[model samples]
Target: MHSLRPCLLFLLLALMISAVPVSAEPPTVMVADYTISPAVLQPGDVGTITAIIRNTATTATVSEKTGLPGSGAFESSKSTDIGVNIESVQLDSKDVEVISGNYKRVGSIGPGQSIPITFLIRAPAKDGIYFPEIWIDVTGGQSVRQPVPVNVNTQIALLKKPALTAIKTVPEAIGPGDEVNARVVLRNDGQSRADQVTVIVNCSSPSITQKTPSTFHAGSLLRGENTSIDMVFLTDKNAPIGINRVCLTISYVNPDGTITSQDEVIGIHVRGRAKIGIASLSTDPVRIRKGDPVSLVIRLENTGTDNANSVKATIDLPFAGNKAAYVGKIEPDNDAPAVFSLQAGSPGTYTYTLTVQYEDDYGVQTREERLQMTVLDGDATGVVIAGLLVFLLCAGAAYWFLTRKKGPGNA
Candidate 1:
């Protein structure tokens, strides 16, 4: 009974220890590293800020006053491993305003785990030194905040003047005799704003003329902003096809009340409509013969500034075998041949049409030209030759008879 009392006392003590509450070390998050793009930024400049955060706690142990009986377990502090849950992250600054990605949710971060949070921030209009604070919220209602140092450069100190750049030209391609509604986009790529911006376009080639206002006035343009100007131009009908260069003169007022100008050249492709025609037509033998193989040769010329594609020429005459010839592509001021081998039918003068087909920028077009061909009868030449020989023989016999009879009388 006395030994039982000691065990009971031990058990009571263990129960008392187990009844005590356990304590655990909470999660601790810290900023591992931070980075900012465009390390030095001017006023009104936008930049990206990234912060790398890490939970330094490798393992969290909870202390619980509890132990098992007889197995050497006693009421004492127990340790439990745990991870940290991040709820939100935010950035705050007076010299810079958060443009986007202010708050982010990072669900769970294990021990020694790190996460990267980024924010798009814009520098304040006024230049100065500033400190942006980063706040991290955890699941346990605990928060961590850190301030980041930033330097906002002044536009004057940075000497970042406004720059005008010709972004693009609309209607990249133009053809002769075409009236084009063209658009030119001008962008301000500098850190300072431009005042009283003016853009003037000039044509270097006489074949191109501006039909609209040559100069355009843009009131004001902020940095990183773009404006477009619409203009009309006419391409002369006799304009040579190639690349045409146009000059753009841009002038604007600088922040220091000085006028700055820049000149740029833009090249535009000038394409002309494809025009094809039959330059010459001839046959191998010059004259056609019935039942004989005839070779028809057609010369096609491209008179336009562009190349003619998929050129095909066909003879519509009544003949056998292939009557079509594929000439492929013909370049400007160049000619190609279309030959066909056919057998002529009957003799006599026959009128036929030569059809030329080709494709251009617009679409397919066909041209027909009337041709007069004289085909001789295969047996007519033989007949005519035989008759002429017979006539000559008769004349010779008559002449001999007359001469010989007269001479005999004289003898």
Candidate 2:
């Protein structure tokens, strides 16, 4: 009875152990810890995120059913597989952008294995606290997500340079001794705002000077905002013609409490007013007979701000000697003379055209005036004496005939 009792107890323990079902343990994968390079970042700063992924799953073994060789009986074959495969990785945040290596593939991980995954990210433009969500997708398993906290320090504001342009000028074209009004446009083309902006004009040339205050102050300028400044400038009376350059200095304070300065150049064109005219025209002899020599004189004047160079005068007449004369340069408010000798032709009255041409700073100019000349007959005195003698003889004859004829008729 004792031996039977021992056998029964052993059989009961075997049955109980065989009745329990056997199952394989599942894989466990998670993110253990993470590290960030340059934890504190400013707006538009680039940073890197590195995460440590650990697989805490033990080796899994499964049994596969196989048929026995040449027999209907079946046998069990044991097989072992390890680790979990990671399908993809992603980062989520409106303020952050993934520059590179966003989605990555980790083929498989063994039991008790850890791997590092890296990602490149850019910070937001504004300064504040941000939380970027990082997610890892596992093949045939649940997805893992983690929230990463980032501190954005924006006490030091970013600075953007301002743009300066010349919008318009009151007088499109300017002359010497003329006052010009110029409008300058300033625009903030950068992402950051500027404070306490100022502009100064530097007239390095002696020909130009500022008529009003040379400095202008603009309180604040926001991104994409624009403003204008009006300035007056006076050009010297002796300023030369062509293009002139002026320098402008701009200074502004940034949000970081720093001063920045920049220099720009502006081009201004200066043209001188040029005027030329024929001052006077005269002949040497006031009265002249036929076939007599006459001398002609012409005077030219420059009545404007620019000098007249290469002055010349020409006479258009029937009889003349050396018709053209060189008068040389005539300065502003100055005159030059040209003389020529001419022979008179057989004519009662003659008219000539006196043309004066000159080159000035602007261009070539010409002026024409009428010239009148009179010529008398050489035998005018002799003919007048002969006619007087004939008239006296005829009057004497008529007086004697009248007295004699009256006596005869009375007898």
Candidate 3:
């Protein structure tokens, strides 16, 4: 029984030990992928970044290194995409340091099957070209590498640009807070499609939005062909009155895989910075007898967005002698009419012109219209003479009959 008791104790101890859970080993890791949104920027600019790191069958520290600088004009911050050991932001242009806390690593690119990390990169303030690099180091997994480009031109010039004649505004008289669409038409004077081209349009108003691509290829555009982009300028509620200037830059790819770029400037006029005006005129058709007089009326409207001073209206008068009656100013939502009388001494179709002139705070405004009428004639003078002769003959006959009968019956 004592021997059985010792065996029982041993069995109990073994069962207790078996019931305990075993410890687990950590996971393996690797950095297999990375992405950069807008991998390019100008000096003193910033970019958004994304990265992936993975752990393989073994646990280990994952380290990443960005593409190192190749020239004095080009470089990247180890802090831009560096590990803990190298934690400093770098740039090819010296001015990038002027902006504090612009670029940094968001989180540890720790080891895993694959983990994503984000970052911000700041461009140097100076002008030049820079190629950024990213390198991922895994204890057991293969190293990953990526390169980004930063084209900094203190000159604000695009890399490859195309030729532009001009950028014009559609309605040059838009006030603040008004919606406007401006267009830039470019012809591929070069022998390319204008691929990979970047177009930048600027307006004095920040409310404007351009729909064209930031970059494009010149080779993609054919010669004698034109491509246009629209920029909607949202007027500010309180914009200054006067002329607003708009600037444009075009960067394009050459057929030989080279890049060229160009720039242009345009302007728009705002009279009141918030007012608009409209002018209209209309005419009617009429007929007249030869050697007779005819009259007609003309209607004028000041369908204006604002009040206008010294408004005038004129209409073309037929070749015949004509006179016009003056009409007064037309109020908003109202109209004015003028009457014109003409003597149609001829038998041909007559055409007339009407001109309207007015002055406002801005300047002089004019409008024109045409008037048409026909005059009929059937040998008008001869017909009237013949009718008078016939009437005289009938009068003579009647007078003779009455005179003879009265003479015979008279006492």
Candidate 4:
């Protein structure tokens, strides 16, 4: 009976422990930021105070343990969405009077989410600094409490700082060996003035160089004031294509004589161009004659920074052979030949047009030039044959006349 009583007691204890519910870790909530409109309030002015709260947890974890004795027990974990439910938000207005913006029964905020709550309030009748606080209550999470500063016509400045912003204007696209024009505008977006302002431009690429002075001195800039600086840059003939980065460093002196500096980046897109032209022209036979077979070759040269593709040339001449020839690809600083086999026509100086077509990054392009070629009279073989026949006929007539005179003398 004593052994059975102990076993019964142990079973009863296990049942009670299993009946109890397990509690999970609470979600954390914090005040992200707060803003007050009309930063400086008059003695009896009304303004709005806004408070933003957020949940900073990445994920919620729930753990469970199971299995009986000697049954190889293990713990399993699950991920769940744990959101905070806002019950109420109140502003503790000590010196300031609350107008009408207390919130109640506000919804929920998920992890990594934030919400903004606004309250309308009026300033006190005294001209001094006041510290007001906000209290927030959320279900199943840690509460949030934060304090904000309120000024009533006081001489003390909240934050006396200078903020400089740079706005730049640059050409959309630049080609190799081109002169570029650019401008940068410096503006003071702060409440204080900046003195001894200077800007310097720098580029790591040797292909890009500054044409004008690389530094600009603006002297001073008052609050809400802006100034512009003009700059010029030159690109080398072999400058690389694509985006080129240039850095601009700005330095200025604050009211307290402290030097501050910041860096801004400017991107310049450089698209290369392929310059194609006819370098030379030649023929197989130095002197072409009528009714002769000839071979004409046009040398196409690429002098630009890019490659020319699918190059072709055509001649608009009165020839009886092939008129078009394909030159294939011509790389920068290189040349290719386009050849055509033609039959010479009537003897005369023939005025013709030569058209060259190629493609680059800019798509299909064509170049045309007016050219002239002269052909001599028909082959000299025909003239030599006529002279030989005339000589033969004259010799025969002389022979007959001599024979007749000789026969009469003999008789």
Candidate 5:
């Protein structure tokens, strides 16, 4: 019974100990947490930080000043007596003294409370990962800071190797006074997006009259985006319509930021030929006596890439005499008509060959065209007037003879 009492007493003492109220201790004031808004950014992207700082000291620092180390800080966030000031942010390698106007200073962070410090930082240009280092100042000549990490990237397009989707050339052949058209669509096949891409095109044996915009604004061309361009060629009558080839180069990119370019050839068959039919001349009636003036007309057209420079177009009427005029330069895409007159008053069917010639880098090239001219038989229509005058003179002689005869009879 005595042993039981001791055990009972021990149990009662344990109960009493358990019944005692436990005083909760104050939470340790220590800041180990930080947060950065917008976990990602690009160059010139602004960011801010909200720091939860817990002051561990049971008592507050006498001085309200607090801040991180470093100079050239421009702005400060609300913080301790020593506010946090962030200057212009710059890359450390940029050999510049300071970047200004980045962060602002704020009041001090209190004990067992969280303090938010804001700072701004710029990003570098590239496609890789990166982050910024930051600090916060506190009282007692001690500063606390938390490094916030952020990812930086770009959304710009790049021109990489490009492929062609559609290629078309119009009018395989054009006669001496005609035109041709060609078009091609470029497609981006790589994985990088393409912007402001231009295709430089060159054509052989053909002159370009009209080309699509000299530059192609790919406009964020993603992989598989197609852009089209056009080219026009005016074939000269002297042009040989057979086969012409042009070269095209494309610089393009895809969505993944890869760039590429390729040069390609487009083979076009030139087919049209220029034709010059004869046009009528003035003065159809034939005057078969002396040299009379005859007018000749001819049409000149640019049927090729070459132009007629200081063109002297003339009609060579066989016997009547040849005539020519100095027509100004005519471009391949247009036409000009030349007129000249000659004198041929002979009585024979005359044929002459009129040739149009122009100067080029290789010297003069000529176009000789043949046409038929004729003169008809002349009539007494030329002598009829002479006979009338002779008759009038005879009338006067007869009247005088009659008057003499009558006067003698009367006498």
Candidate 6:
């Protein structure tokens, strides 16, 4: 009975060990990518190398179980965290000198997480390509290592530069006292990414004022990424009539910590508006008489900044002669005359309409003005009265002469 008791205890220990849960797989880490600043480093120049370390595990917790088959001692599945602790990160120098020390006890990384590790390094005094290896150690997991290529004093280009382009949208033609809406589109056309991009805009003429802020900040632009900025401007009523320039200053930081600037120009066309007015109205003769010829003159003036074309004037007076006149073109701050020849109508005051037509930047326009004129009647009754008085006087003189001659001689 004593010998049997010892064997039974051994069997109980084996059963307990078989029912214990164990991990099926351990967490793993890897170096996803790496970058070196100042791609082409001169001999003895210090630069930085950055690597992205990521955890390959996809889930936060994994189900695990272990048991002896058909022993009726099966264990339920248990969950375990797949987090990885970064023990240390070091850069092994081959032909380059590591300036920054290795990283120790960084922290834990959750499943599918990534972190960037950077180290300062100096190039050796040789004109060739060098390989630098980066080692990342994980606690209770496999270590990760990757080799990065560095260019030292060689003509080979290792880093791709960032290139940016600007596209603008503006109105084809804008007039004074108009609101100008504009847009600028920024695009990254290079292989690398651009950071901290800023844009500033200004107009060349003082007459053109900005309605919004001139500065815009675009945080970051990845490869083949794009952004847009909207801007507004207000033009003065008397702004210059011509092509104006809008200057754009773009600045951004490259991946190598270098600042780059670009200057671009866009044009805004300003068209002039023309305004026409009536300067004066008069006639060639001071006063008009019935059955007489008269000339009516109307002076047209331009007060705006552009020329008025195809100018014509017409009068609505009840006359028999020409009533329409063509003045051709009138320039800004200038005047032109339209003359109409007509015969005087009747006596008393006569009301008429003066219609003026012209073409300007805004298209065809017409204006009407009311005016009045006076005409005097003709003289005919005074001539008949004078003829009757002369006839009576000649008869009296003949009778007196015949009586005086008969009394003095024949009696």
Please write out the lDDT profile of model 2 over residues 155-187, one tens digit for every residue: 333334544333444455678888877777888
- After superposing all C-alphas onto the true structure, candidate 1 shows an RMSD in angstroms of 16.9
Better of 2 and 6 by TM-score: 2
lDDT of 4 by residue, 1-411 (tens): 887998998886574433212455477777788888889999999998988888777576666555453443654557677888888888887799889778899888888999998989899999998887888888876677788888899869665767899998989888888888888999999889999999998654678888889888999999999999988888887788887777889999999889999999877778877888889999979799998899999898998777898999999999999999998999899999989899999999999999989888778889898999899998698899999999999999999998998896697
lDDT of 2 at 53: 80
TM-score of 1: 0.48
Between which residue pairs do clashes occur in model 4?
none
Candidate 1, residue 166: CA error in Å?
7.8
Q: In candidate 6, how many Å is residue 312 off? A: 2.8
Q: Quote model 4's TM-score.
A: 0.51
TM-score of 5: 0.37
Decreasing TM-score order of the candidates: 4, 2, 6, 1, 5, 3
lDDT by residue (229-261, candidate 1, tens digit) is 887777887777777777888899999999998
Q: Name the runs in model 2 displaced over 4 angstroms.
A: 1-172, 204-209, 236-246, 380-411
**What's the distance in Å from true for residue 337, model 5?**
6.3
What is the TM-score of candidate 6? 0.49
Give the better candidate number (2 or 6) by lDDT.
6
- Per-residue error at 186 for model 5, in Å? 7.2
The superposed Cα distance between candidate 1 and the true structure at residue 9, in angstroms, equals 81
Root-mean-square deviation (CA) per prediction:
16.9, 16.8, 20.0, 18.1, 16.1, 17.5
* TM-score head-to-head 2 vs 4, winner: 4
Alpha-carbon runs more than 4 Å astray in model 1? 1-173, 177-194, 202-247, 254-267, 381-411
Candidate 4 segments whose C-alpha is farther than 4 A from its true place: 1-160, 170-181, 234-238, 241-244, 253-259, 267-274, 285-293, 304-310, 346-348, 359-365, 374-381, 384-411
Indicate the residue-level lDDT of 78 in model 6: 56
